[model samples]
Target: MQFDRDRFRFGIEAEYLLADKATFRPLWHNDVTFAELHNLMEAIPFDDLPSMDGLELEPPHRKLMPYVVEGYHVPNPDFSPIDILPKGVEIRTPVCSSIGECLECLKTLHDRLEAALSGSGYTLVSLSHHPTEHHFEGPQNKRRYDFWQWAMEVMTTCGPDINVSLPRELNDPIDVADLHRKVNYYSPALAALSLASPIYRGKLWKIRGTVGKSIRTYRRSVIAPAIELHPEENGRMEFKLFEATNRLEDYHAFFLLWLTLLLDEGLKGRSRDQSRIYDLGAVARFGLEAETVRERAGEVFAQAPVVLNRHGFDAGPLNIMKKRLETGRLPADDIIDYFDETGSLEDVLKTRTGLIHGTELAQDSSVNAAALSRSRQSMTGI
Candidate 1:
């Protein structure tokens, strides 16, 4: 069950918070906003997708909550306030043959989605949890989310990670259990590389009073070989490690890094000690500043370039990981530092495009940050 680079393709599922620009708090008006979105998407005049990044004519149909069965959903106007996630929309990309194609398609999908959100007052943001907030709203569906709400309430206080999907064709030979083990072993590296959720309920995770700790992704590990790996299911597997990263560089770098590492036999089960599992939690808690995992991540990043270069990726995209190793400055680190300096989350999230602007750390021009259409609509209050 060797990694098949030629046969592999990937997609993205980016979750965003529908936030009130004034208070930096999460908001969701499922009735008006959801209908606006639906009607706008409904008006699009296409049956089948034309291209990965081309104009999409179809939108995911909305379903009532309770999540009784696996299905798609529209907003529930009849319900009261709920956690922004259940009501918030996730911009997903169609499975694409290459990283470039996937990203391009995502850009288009994101653009059209944002266009629909125009005049809606609420804007999309990629915060893991409301920076300084809590949810008192009831579940989206009593039957479906009741169990989830209970578990998240009973088991953990935090929420989901920035999950992505990589496609392996149905015809490809994938040993489910073996592949699952290898993937779970390496999944933590993705979280370490793409850490965007640093603050929760208005303070740094370390100091936040709510949970006594932050880093939502580490609250629990999912049942491995998540969904798409099932024999009868879709031909994709989920990487449930990363928090919400709005950067294209992080998206591209992550999937490519996964591919490279997957192919590198030396990287598989490279850690012999407890650090393999413990360090993922450390990464969630401290980003690249985690002492032990950062060291190991550096070693892996150093080796991945050779493999990435072989696959026609210039390796410049992996610069974020390199920057993290050299300086211990993941994206979350800088964002936190900036917030500490100015006491502004909106400024940091709004102005910073990716982790690659005016960067003195590594000036690799080949390292591309393809955020051509960044939304500058500031979530500010007068």
Candidate 2:
């Protein structure tokens, strides 16, 4: 399908840990202290670099309105042994309209931050989560703290302590809806982007996406809301609908549905079985939809003939589907092979029989072109 060329853009938001001016170790201080340090740095003129210096400013506290903090322990009135304090600094790169531009901006920002902090008795550590970082009793900013306090009361009742950064540049300008979808669809990939929480409290956590998991969990409890997609109105494969439904339920449900769909495709000899298939039935039992269950068993007969004519049971589609299916569940290989395999409509039709020939897939089905377009735009960052 033809795609909108103007949909690609990139931005970066980097969160840094604050440390003592004398010691290089993680520092825990109140909001006043952090604000003072931030002010001090703001007043200093530093040379810029590609990776660190291209940053626009210490991201104003207002930009982090969307995030909530949780998972880390905070001191409470009932049991207050030692004061728990945490300080953070945020840096946002210049927004680029393309991936290439974004990368260039990132390089500049990275270099600037490095040069500016050198020999300053401070450094910025790139990580999804810091093992030694502790949570303060409350949020650093009043707006964040108040909003989260109310949000937790209305939502899943969790604390907020998460931080996020986006690239400063974009290759293209994206629609608002597409932006949301991009944020939601690529969440797992973004989660994979900086999986630096391998060690928690100075011990191996044995989880690859520790920061991803913690952030997602905290989001679900504090930010995510119950929303649904109307198939007739929104169209199939819409990210908003998909995310709305996915967020309304548990991750297990989402995973089960994804696995079932893949299995159905596989049973028809349309694809190869992934290692996770061994646990399919158990996953299905964990609240999978009846439609998914039926589809899994019936897919072989339903799509078999078409799949046979299309790809002839090659592993490419299966592999791609498996990577998409396994997101947020397990550790995946690079998936570079599958990533490059997604083909055009004609390519798909030549490989799969049921697909309409020489026509957009959205046109042939009830799929919403706008939604699909947005999803693709978000996924490809194009």
Candidate 3:
């Protein structure tokens, strides 16, 4: 298959704690700070390979350097990538436009770095989080310092730390509008799926989704239209509704219903069968629920229409019903009644089709359905 640059490009920006050449302990005594580190690294001949921590440091670009520097105050003594730091060490490799290329790059870099570091009696590791190590400072390089300072300022004003990752599936170059939709749709789901940081500062926080909370905070501070909780007077859970709109709307109603049924069955008793059912049910429920509402809305199209309209569009009231059902804002039976009352299913379909296909729907108002649909189809080949 021909490589799809948009879909196939994969890159990894990893941050690893700097460890001592021996005993694999965090290195705390470097005179050159992160800002200085970048400058110094940049000044070093790109062609001149350095043997540090037993790894050979080769610049990715002949004009500049390969290492994208990030610094932390904490000392990570372990070789496990997990124990790196909170705002720990970061390693940014070259941008690979394909997954195969990316994997190859990772392998090559890993091998070279390991060999170079081995000579120095040290190694590098990869992981998401670590529980043991703490205490670190940002890099000293002017650019790195500026970035960390800005990030800290924004985050401090917001709430907490947030981290997120998305599947490689949506990496393809998509229409700007479709990209927006997919980003808006999958962000919440990905946030939910990748929420692994539960215990922070050695305490069990009540937040069920640590990663989501962190991201929510980041979006509020860094991203525009920061998420605000509905006031008690408003009688609304702000985040809840947002999640429903973005992810739930894109999921299949039957799939969601199946999950709900499983959950119900699992919660009925404490038997081993019930426990097993509950586990499966829980995973399904969370997985489906995490999907963005817009994505869910897309999934609704996959279902066979129970009712069709004069235009031959399956835009039955079922779509609306599905939305309400997924959102828990209305009873399933009530949705059916509402669907019966709604006009032509084709009209409804047109409305949804318009919403999805519209260009820059989030940022622009002039986009139309036909344009949006064509753009999406062209990008995804759907």
Candidate 4:
């Protein structure tokens, strides 16, 4: 089978916290809001995604609403991974042939979401962890156990899954496994670039101190899967190490870097899962400040240009990661600094990532529930 580069698709699913616009606290009793958002999202038209002959998407989940309600789950011996309680919302992009298309799709979904929430007293925030409010639990199964902590972890953390699906012609298991292994090896260094969860347990981690770049990453160490390959055939490789970032361009950079790594045959660096897990723990604490992580990340950043160039991809997107590595800084640094300067978590939350705010939102007279409904009906044939 001849592999056509155009057949490769890019997609993303980003999870965000729903917060009270005024108080900046996690918004509770949000099912109605989520339902409304999902309905509006469903109204958006999705194109018939490019597909290969004789291949089908095993789950066909991408065809659903672009925005989905996300929940937290605890493992049970009887029904493990089944019991889930809603905690946040996720924005998923339609699979597209180019990173730019994926970015635009994400932006459209985000804008619609923002328009819906403009006057509703709620706002979507992109962050790895919620600033306040713990003790999250469902009505039943409040039993104390090691597994219950897993649900708590999910409730508190939010992030994005950067997905890359290979062309069906190239879906070789050996090649897929190699890509998975390479992604796992470099997960720690790549994760360090977007560490934004500086708050933990309802306070600045270490109380205005820089103990680590991300408290969330430190907690998820080895317990959670950092990367996943889905569908029995023509699998989509999803890298889950990135924290939620405000800028879509940051996501573009990360996606391009993943693609570069996927295509780079010359880069031979690899590591055992155990070593990668250990490095992730260190990165959680020190981020790029960790000498080992910085060195490894530096090497990857240096090689990215070569791979991107060879593959006919523009190398400009990498400047974000390059700058972070150069300065030993991550998004967490900015969050921590802002909190220190203002002494108000609400002020920090007010800083926009992808959502509209203030007068700009007031001027968005075009998007509304009815408009979305009419649009949804028109696009149903898609």
TM-score for each model: 0.68, 0.38, 0.36, 0.79
Clashes of each: 11, 56, 47, 1
Report lDDT per candidate: 0.49, 0.29, 0.29, 0.67
Q: How well does candidate 2 score on lDDT at residue 318?
A: 28
Best by TM-score: 4
lDDT for each residue of candidate 2 in 1-382, tens digit (9 for 90 to 100): 2223233222433344434334445443432243444344454332231233222222332222211112222334443212223344444444333323333333344444444454455544432334343232343222356554543332111111111121112212323343333233222221221122222333333334332223222223223321222223211111111110101011112222222222222332221123113222222122122124223323333443343224212222223223433342322111111223652212211221110111112221112346445433433212
If ranked by TM-score, best first, what sequence of candidates would result? Answer: 4, 1, 2, 3
The prediction achieving the highest lDDT against the true structure is: 4
Instruction: After superposing candidate 3 on the true structure, give the runs of residues whose Cα lies further than 4 Å from its correct spot.
Output: 1-10, 19-63, 72-91, 95-97, 118-122, 128-149, 153-178, 195-199, 202-382
Give the poorly placed runs of model 1, Cα more than 4 Å off: 1-6, 21-25, 29-37, 40-85, 135-174, 207-214, 220-234, 270-277, 352-382
lDDT of 3 by residue, 63-126 (tens): 2344544433322333112111123333333443322232233334444444444564444432
Give stretches of model 2 more than 4 Å off.
1-7, 19-24, 30-32, 39-86, 139-194, 205-221, 224-382
Model 4 backbone overlap count = 1
